[model samples]
Target: MIEGRVWKYGDDVNTDVIFPGKYTYQPLEPAEMAEHAMENLDSSFAKEVKKGDVIVAGYNFGCGSSREQAATCLKAAGIAAVIAKSFSRIFFRNAINNGLPVIELEDGVDDMEKGDTVSIDFEAGTVTHKGNAYHFPALPKEVLAILNDGGLIPHVRKQLGRE
Candidate 1:
């Protein structure tokens, strides 16, 4: 179970806006990458985001180029999870591989507002907002394992007995 404060947004939030294309070429550390998260979409986001904050967005969230940094930057920015009405397939996979939990809540987005407190139970596949619970398909065990181990690379390293 993960609970956090919401940082809401609308549909079609692309990779560039999630983590601007200009800084993509730089050899930025995770913290540095976080500093630029949502600079394009919400200039105040990087500065105001707190650890364990959640992002609640509308349909086609993450609809843009398949840059892994889009997911990476959000995770680095201390986003515990992203709850959207829908997601770009590539971005969805990238998020899981990067240890960022992306939950698809087709309903209840309208009920949630910025700064609202929300709770997500991955095991039960429910998102509780303001005492109401919305459901989504539970994540598969394999995907959960990857997220639990902190992304694909870390999971693989552990599987190979390297960590």
Candidate 2:
């Protein structure tokens, strides 16, 4: 079970808004990048986000650019998961590769408001918020494996027992 307060956002929240391009040349680490997470959209996001806080957004979330830092920043910012109506294809892959679960729901965020306490059961593919339950197709075993081991790197590490 994953539980957290909802931090709602709108559609087409691009990678640039997520981490900004000015800092891209700096090669800042995840922690450094996290300090700027959502700074453009919400300046206080990085400092205010508590561990396990959930991010809910509208369709086409994570659109624009294919930078992996977008996902890295969110994970480093301690986001529990991102439940959106849709996501850019590369962003979706980057998120899963970096250990952040991105869930798609057609109307899930419509009923959610900022700061709504939400709970998700990946095994059951159910999301509960404000007494409303949203269900999705069960996550595949491979996806679960990557998430369970904390992204692809750790999952691969556990598989080989070493690099």
Candidate 3:
């Protein structure tokens, strides 16, 4: 179960607002990037987010530049998963490749409000909040394999008996 205080955002929450373009020149360190995550949008996000917290957004979350930092920062920031109405193709793949679980909810994240305690059952593809159950498409086993092992590299290492 993935549970935390819900951080709600509207549609088209792009990467620039996510990681910010001003810091694009900086080193691609997860910690550094995380410190600036949502700085361009929600000023207190980086400082306030808790481990296992879920990012609930509208359509096309991560809809800007295809920088992998956008995904890595969120992962490093301790976001358990990103549940959105839709995601940009590249962002979605980057997130999966980096071990950040991203969920696409057709019904939108309307039932939950910011600061509301929310929980998601990834295996069951259901989100529960205040007795409300929101269903999302179940992630494929292959995708879960990567996330389970904490991203692709670790999973590959495990498969090859190297880690």
Candidate 4:
């Protein structure tokens, strides 16, 4: 079971705002880079976010650029997961590679409110909020394995060790 504080956002939260184009060439340090995450959408986002909070947003989340820093900043900001109606392909892959779970729910944003407590059952692919259950498409086995091992790199390392 994954439980956390919920932070709500609207649609089209692109990558430029997530990591900001200006900061992309700098460094990959999450703590410092996190300062710019969502600055265009909400300047106070980094400060307002609490550890273990989940980001609930509308469709097309993370839709610009291919920088993994956007995912890095969110994880470094201590976001447990992101629940969105849809996600950009690259961002989705980056999130999984970085050990951050992203759940694509058809109507997830509609049922979630800012600051609401949310619980997610990964194995069952269900999200529970205010006594309501929302179902999401199950992740593939390979994707689940990446998340289970704390991202792709660590999973590869573990596999090598076993071999």
Candidate 5:
């Protein structure tokens, strides 16, 4: 179960805005990457985002170059999960690989607004907000394991008993 305050956005939020391209090549750490998360779209996000906050967005939520930094920065910024109407194919996979819980809530997303409190039960595929429950397909067990282990690399390491 993941519960948090919603940080909402609209469609087609690309990588450049999520994490500015200016610092992409720099050898910044996770914390540094977080400092710039959503800097272009929402300048206050990095400074104000709290741990376990959820991002609710519209269709094509991550629609841009497959920069892994996009997902990495959001995770480092303490985004617990992202609920969107749809996602770009590459960004969807990248999010999973980064241990970010992303759900495709085709309906009821519009009912949510910024600063609204939401709760997600990944195993149940439900996003609860303001006494309303929105449903999406539950993620598979393998994917859940990866997220549980904090991402693909960690999950693989644990499976091989090398953690």
Candidate 6:
């Protein structure tokens, strides 16, 4: 179960804005790079976000670069989950690999507003907001196992059982 404050965004929020290229050579620390997260889309994004807030966006979200920093910055900023109409392939993988839940919703982004409260049940593939329920495609069992274990590396480590 994932529950948090919701933040809304539009379509095609690419990775460059999530983690600016200008800061790519700077550092890997979450805090160091977080201030620049979504800089292009919303200059005040970093300051406005609060811990445990979830980001809801329109189609083709995270549409550029293979940088995991985009996912990293969001996690660092304390975002709990990301629900979008569609996602870039690499970004989707990176998000799950880093243990950040990313859900793909079909439509109705315009119906939601920032600061709305949301709850997601990954196992059931259902999202609840203001007493309304929205359904999404269910992830495969294998993928769910990895997510439940808190990401690929950890899931692998558990399978290996190396302490």
* Runs in model 4 lying further than 4 Å from the true structure: none
Q: Report per-prediction Cα RMSD to one decimal.
A: 1.1, 1.4, 1.6, 1.6, 1.3, 1.5
76, model 2: CA deviation in Å? 0.9
Candidate 6 ranges with C-alpha deviation above 4 Å: none
lDDT of 6 by residue, 16-101 (tens): 98888888877578886777788888887899988888999999989989998899899888888899999999999888888888
TM-score per candidate:
0.95, 0.93, 0.91, 0.94, 0.94, 0.92
Error (Å) of candidate 1 at residue 145 is: 2.1
lDDT of 1 by residue, 1-163 (tens): 8889999999898888998888888899888999999999999999999999999999998888888888988999999999999999999989999999989888899889999999998888899998899999977889889988889999999999997
After TM-score superposition, the amount by which residue 13's alpha carbon in candidate 2 deviates from its true location, in angstroms, is: 0.8
Worst 10 residues of 3 by lDDT: 105-114
| lDDT of candidate 2 at residue 152, scale 0 to 100 | 90
Query: What number of clashing residue pairs does each candidate have, in the order they appear?
Result: 0, 0, 0, 0, 0, 0
Residues 39-115 of candidate 3 have per-residue lDDT tens digits of: 88999899999898899998899998998889999999999888899999989988988999899995748766789
Candidate 1 has what TM-score? Answer: 0.95
Q: lDDT of each structure?
A: 0.91, 0.90, 0.87, 0.89, 0.90, 0.86
Q: Give the RMSD in angstroms, all C-alphas superposed, for model 6.
A: 1.5
Score candidate 5 by TM-score against the native.
0.94
Residues 1-163, model 5: lDDT tens digits: 8789999999999888998889999999988999999999999999999999999999998888888889999999999998999999888888998999889997788889989999998767788998989889977788778878988899889999996
Minimal lDDT window, size 10, model 2: 136-145
lDDT by residue (1-163, candidate 4, tens digit) is 8999998988888998788888889856788877777777888788898889999998999998999998989998889999999999999999999999999997556878988999999989899999888989889998999999998889999989953
Error of 5 at 125 (Å): 1.4
Better of 3 and 5 by TM-score: 5
